[model samples]
Target: MPESATLPSATTKLEYLRKDLEDLRYYLDEFSAFLPLSVIIVNPQGFILDINQAFENLIGLEKAGVLGSTVAKLFCEQEQFAELEARVLKGEVIKGARATLLLRDRQISRSLYLSPRHDCEKNIIGYFLGIYDISENVKLTEGRNGTVCARTIELEEKSEDLLRSRAALMNILEDVAEEQKKVEQERDKTLAIIKNLADGILIFDPHNVLTLINPQAKEMMQLDESSVVGKMAAALTKVTNIMPLINFLGRNIKKVYRKQLELKSDKVLEISAFPFLTGRETLGKMVILHDITREKAIETMKTEFVSVAAHQLRTPLTTVKWSLHLLLHGNLGAITAEQRDLLMRTDEHNERLIGLVNYLLDVARIEQGRFVLRNKNVDFIKLAETVIAPFLEVSKNKQLNFKFIKPREKVLPVNVDEEKMVLVIENLVDNAVNYTPPHGNVTVSLSFDKAKSEVLFTVKDTGIGIPEDNKQRIFTKFYRAENAAMASTSGSGLGLFITKNIIEGHGGRIWFESIQSKGSTFSFTLPLK
Candidate 1:
């Protein structure tokens, strides 16, 4: 072997080592590119030797510009960075230590993990540092803490509102409970009053179903409350005790007022019906039954007394009338002019007394239900003419303008009692002539309603009209208006009462319309059949 080839020259060994170093640097760059965390290599002097792409992005700087920079210049906390370096040089590994990374325009919070790099001889030469961004995590933790505090405050406020609402609701519930108690008490009191009331009471709903029947009502109707209540008016018609009332009311349940209903021959009741109203709404109906049997019996006795008294005086009055008539006409003996005049006046007085007695007898017969009607078809026009002929002279004497208005179609006939109907016309005509003032008008009209098969007779007179307070008793027995009594002392106050009875007996209706100080109109309707 040649002496120069025995061992490689020193220059040749240097070139070989230089190639190995270049290969090692290439491998380290390749390994750092794959690492996810921001990574940097620091020399023993604390200067940055190299950095990965992740570290360049975190510092917003290029790796070429950051190379050879002091590691402490990249961090805001110099003292902490120095501590981390010293600890790493002493062979202690550091992990998750907080540090702030400096950028060109801003700062970034980061967690630093440092580990010392060693040579083949196990001697520390440099440090490998890994960094993690903690800026977003720190912001999220602070936000979460603040959110917890705000939520606690909101929960407290909601709890306070809930307490206030609970108290208000309790007050409302207490008030409602008290009002309900008062209502129950009032209902109990009302029920007690109705149970013990003398008058009978029945309450019905709008559907006409009986809802409540007081004890008095049950007793008066002779019915059990369980069986009668909750029954419709139509269904109750089958009950014999209440049938008459149901039939009378019919469909006019709200229109009845103080109408007489005879439950039996010995029992009579005055019933009134009214509605339960709330504002303009009709809620239901209420019926009240009041006993009137005793009143009717008393009235019957008084009528009987009047009938007997009138009967006893009738014979004597007839005898006096005949005796006075003979004396006035000179049938007994001749008399002087003065005596004749005196007897004429006496005869006039006797005639009036006889008329009163006849009126009383008619009233008695009417009250006893003995007023029989002999109905016959007769020309009412001719009858009215005959009755009016006698009144023409009397009206003329009073200086009254008397008019008789008759339908164009004559011969209007009606089925009625001839004698009683003649009396009715005479009574009406005589009253008009007597009561009317001089120069006032007395109109008698007769009309026929073919549609209704009835005849209407009207006698209107401009007389002393009835007073407002005295009008209700105008047709009652022995009842005289204040104005009528003041106008004449001779009125018996029984003419209208008799007239009404006679007219009603013939299936007719009579009514009068009068205004005080104005005038009066008396009208009547009679069925033709």
Candidate 2:
């Protein structure tokens, strides 16, 4: 808690004696009567100094009867009342702590603001406590059906007496009251935004009571707004069939929780719950329900189309590849040099087409969530050697320097899908050789990093680097760099996209560094264990 500055001048200060604080307290009490919300003034030690007409009516207590009483004696929840009283007396201000109250044996929900009161001398004295009722739509239900409620707000008070101070308690109260009116206006705007949202919005308190449900949420969940606000979450779950969503909220209160729930054969909901935290108190939780049924359906249809198309294309492509292989190997018959040369070139293009089809099928499987890995421990050193070995021959024909820098520790075995790992590394090496100019360097290397928990595989190339403007879209499907597209080497751009997915599936990360017209280094890390 902190102290406020003392008032430097008050005309009544010199004229009044020590009892003037009592007179000031009386003036403050008079001011509280004008306030609509229930108000109280309490001493430094938690004893009530005064109560306004609204406070008496709201709490069902006579002002005179509870004047010297403590908050614990009046409120059913002693712990919360005591804690709030203690904080205010220590010079802290507590606001918007929308706490559920068990008053007169009936539950009531309200927002609270408690501020420490200081005299003209600035020494800590009493406190001002205010309550705003939000229980207009509140009700109760308990059984297999029940509702809970909660909102948490906390504040740290000005903890020290200030040297440069000059303000009175009256001025502070006026400021707070003015601020409250502005806050209410902003809250109205927020409500309007929530009401018009496409996604369903549901707010619940710690007591499991549904505090709010936007109109969109009500329509989607088939809820009757007239009866929904006060109902318990358990009963709401029965009506909405959102058991998985409710269960997630129950377990992970501290974090923002999200889960997809299939409520029916045709409907799926992406539910996200965010905890409203103020200081150390978790005031409440806000849940958003996004309808993802249509999106899911579209994704399924796309996957099916890709799968069917790839299957149909795969058969004819394989047949052509085999025929070209037989011709190039002379398995059919001997051929002229010019004829053989044309067949070889055709075979290469056919292979590239087949590779593209394979990549499409892999992407389809990935999108359908069917890309499962059958992992095995494999020596990446030998794997790299085998994949990069062929690139050397291609580099030689282009008159370029290509090399593989194997780590000194040698036998670097990693847990991965060997076939997929080969695709990832080979694609990188192929890109390196394809882009580098004649006589330029392309180096492939492997090393252990992050305390040997991961193995890093890198492909370095001194090539026509990616343009600054186009770098961000490089990993996107069907996107090729301008320079690469202009070059003779053809590329599908899915190579890096698929490579990234493969690395991530292995619990690794892929990243790169490049400067236009200079070089690029593509690296991915795979976990050892």
Candidate 3:
């Protein structure tokens, strides 16, 4: 015979199983309702699938209300319920597991019996839960064992004990309920604050599943709460509006601070992420999106203003500088030593102004993405030497001990824009000399790291080092440390900012270490060609 003819198809078998299960449930329910013991049917997960009328009365809860709730919810001793379920699910039948059943307004002592239910294939599918009220049984047993007068006295004592126990249970339950209410209130307040926050907020659990997305976040991401919550981070990439943010964060939602993400041409957000930690455990991560459109607009406006103002002032400053140069050189007319001195000072001041204007123009170009690099292979040691040569006289005049330490071996050339590289080296050497006190030491060193294929340049100064609190903003544009400002009042504060951009543009890194009142070491590295 063919297999199809010999046995029922899978669909037919499924139909037969369903019919058998329905019939079994019907008979069990009818039989259990008539029995004196309370009975309930629970799935393998311990959720109530069916409850008999007797079980409903025993717990003082309606069958409609009790169905779909966990069996443990009806019991005051949840640990005992858990133990009973564990034993029964392991194919061990439980009999008379003592427990307390929580009623509508009181508690009752009960004994529970649980046995696993199996299908035709002997696979455990559910459990049969039976409860017996043991209070009446205890009373009956006490009455059977003693004389009437002695029993009467014992019964009175037992009654007093039962009343005290019930009173204590009621007090404990009331306290728990009051505490729960307080917790609920606090949770509501926290949710209210998060919901009303101007900044968007997204909270993901340790599994990277979206646990909470506040209203602002939903609106900003243009997502529906019903569709987005409970989704994993990877799944969010499918969403058009939020895809850029997800891509920027990548697969790992690490701790990032104040990084700019342009969601659209008109909308810019400063995104930050941090782990939500409790003690030593990381519970989840929270991503905050703060709108920065207005700040970016204002910054653009300031950069444009600086660029225009610098361009307009440069021509006049150059004219004055050339006129003073001619007069000081006697190209225009013969002048006395005193006139020459005044003209030279005027030329010096004019040059300083021109340098400031140039710095402003460079900053504007950097902001506008117009700063370009023209890279070529050149000896880095020679470049460093050329930049440091001009600072030697300045340091000598201040009586500062200056030194340039180069590597003993010939180093490979680095690919960089020579002009900008000169600026980088000049800025570091100048800061070291200008900040050092008279008789203080300033050292500029160069070394090659073959293992990393890079050259390290360091400038160390035994001078008034940067303050600890101000170290974080050392390379910030136009930011001068209080100590540096006190030491020299003549600086544009744009040198380091421009220097950092140049180094980073060459695919290099720059950093510094300093201790207040001790010394400072500024270092940078460039990859060798």
Candidate 4:
């Protein structure tokens, strides 16, 4: 029985040894299949015992090459190996400590998870180490940081663009608000003017809707202001046929003045339609009507008087002009120098009177719609020089500087009535020189821009400028600045009025800039072809 028991014990010990070897093989196979992760086994003395395929790949060395090597040999720094050894000695699991492993060509950084292994007696036996290659993750994480930084910079640029857009929008809104205020003020003034005028005034929208009617208009139409305020013209004037009035408003013409409309009450009314405009926008229409029954009779009587007076006055003026011309030209006979001088003086005074009469006639012709412009290609530079030559001589007498600045190139030619443009410049320069103090400067200039298709002629003078209070009224007929009147009494105050008419007739624009005691610049633009 003792011999049989010995035999069974020996077989059982052999079976236990085989099973332990098989388990070890299974663990080694499982660890080898783990990709991108390395498995390492070390003895208690920190010498490498076994390594998997991933371990060889991570350390850039073969398994056979690394086995039996001390752990300190793989670490580039001996200090890292010392730390791992201390953890192994303490029988503690050390996790996730990164170290650089040195190779011949490159240094590889690795993360290691080391754990202590012990026997049943609690004696330190070995260590299991797992290593991960973290170089790619490090590079990928740095790239991600760069991407985040770039995105932050892009967002900052977008924020600045949005801020600039907001500021531009605010400026546009402010400008619009300021323009709206000015419009409101002008509207109030126009309404006040309409109310105070003796002639009846009515305003209508494009839809033929009555927007406003002055008190005089309401009374003239024999209707209450409240009743006609929002009502249509057809409704208000139903008792009187208003077809002509409606047709006048609907006409394609921009402006039509002195349209006669006979009412049901047998009243003769003269209606004038003036289209109100804002830039290119047409706001609405304004109609002013005069009860011309009485005025028409008075006007007819005055027309007869003016014609009779002109006819009666022309013969005497003609005779006097011929008589002076004959004497001054020595046409009648040879005469003494003193007699000739006296005759020349009389001729000059008669010529001045004739010029005054001609000015009056021109104003009358313009008012009668008989004045017209003959537009032609005219060089403004030559025109300016010619007009200022006589004035320059006079300027020399006053010890003033008269200068002309012509364009370098031909610039652009203006289609204008040459006679009218010369007269316009002559009037402006004459006014400047007349008001200017002695030793002051007068400059005439012509400039043009082809892109805008416009030509600008300017007459600038160091003169007694118009005060702000009188600036607006300076263009009105017979209206002169206070200082201008005090400085020079010879002006008829019609130069600017006539110049404005001439420019408007040629489809041009005119304006002036001035300051009190700082002089003035009068500029006008002609369309260039």
Candidate 4 structure lDDT:
0.74
The model with the greatest lDDT is 3
Q: Which of the numbered candidates is closest to the native, going by highest TM-score?
A: 3
- Alpha carbon lDDT of each predicted model: 0.82, 0.76, 0.83, 0.74
Which of the two, 2 or 3, has more lDDT? 3
Candidate 4 structure quality by residue, lDDT tens digits, 125-180: 66667666666556655677787577658656755753453333333333334454
For each candidate, what TM-score against the reference?
0.66, 0.58, 0.71, 0.49
TM-score result, candidate 1: 0.66
Q: After superposition, how far is residue 360 of candidate 4 from its true place, in Å?
A: 1.0
Best-to-worst lDDT order:
3, 1, 2, 4
Task: Order the candidate numbers by TM-score, best to worst.
Answer: 3, 1, 2, 4
lDDT of 2 by residue, 315-374 (tens): 999999999999989999999999999999999889988998999898888877788899
Model 1: lDDT of residue 254: 59
Residue 235 in candidate 1 has what lDDT?
A: 86
Q: Candidate 3: where are CA atoms >4 Å away?
A: 1-171
lDDT of 1 at 397: 89
Q: lDDT by residue for model 3 over 1-529, one digit each (tens)?
A: 7766988889999999999867765654455565555667777788887766777777677888887677888888888678788888889877768888788788888887676766545667667776766676577666655565676686667657544533333333333344545766999999899999999999999888888999888877778898878889899888777788889887567789999998775888999999988667788999999988899999999999999999999999999988988897779889999898888888889998998999999999999999999999998888888888888898899999999999999777889999989888888888888788899999999999999999999999998899999999999999999999887547878999999999898889999999987789999998887
Q: What is the lDDT of residue 440 in candidate 1?
A: 90
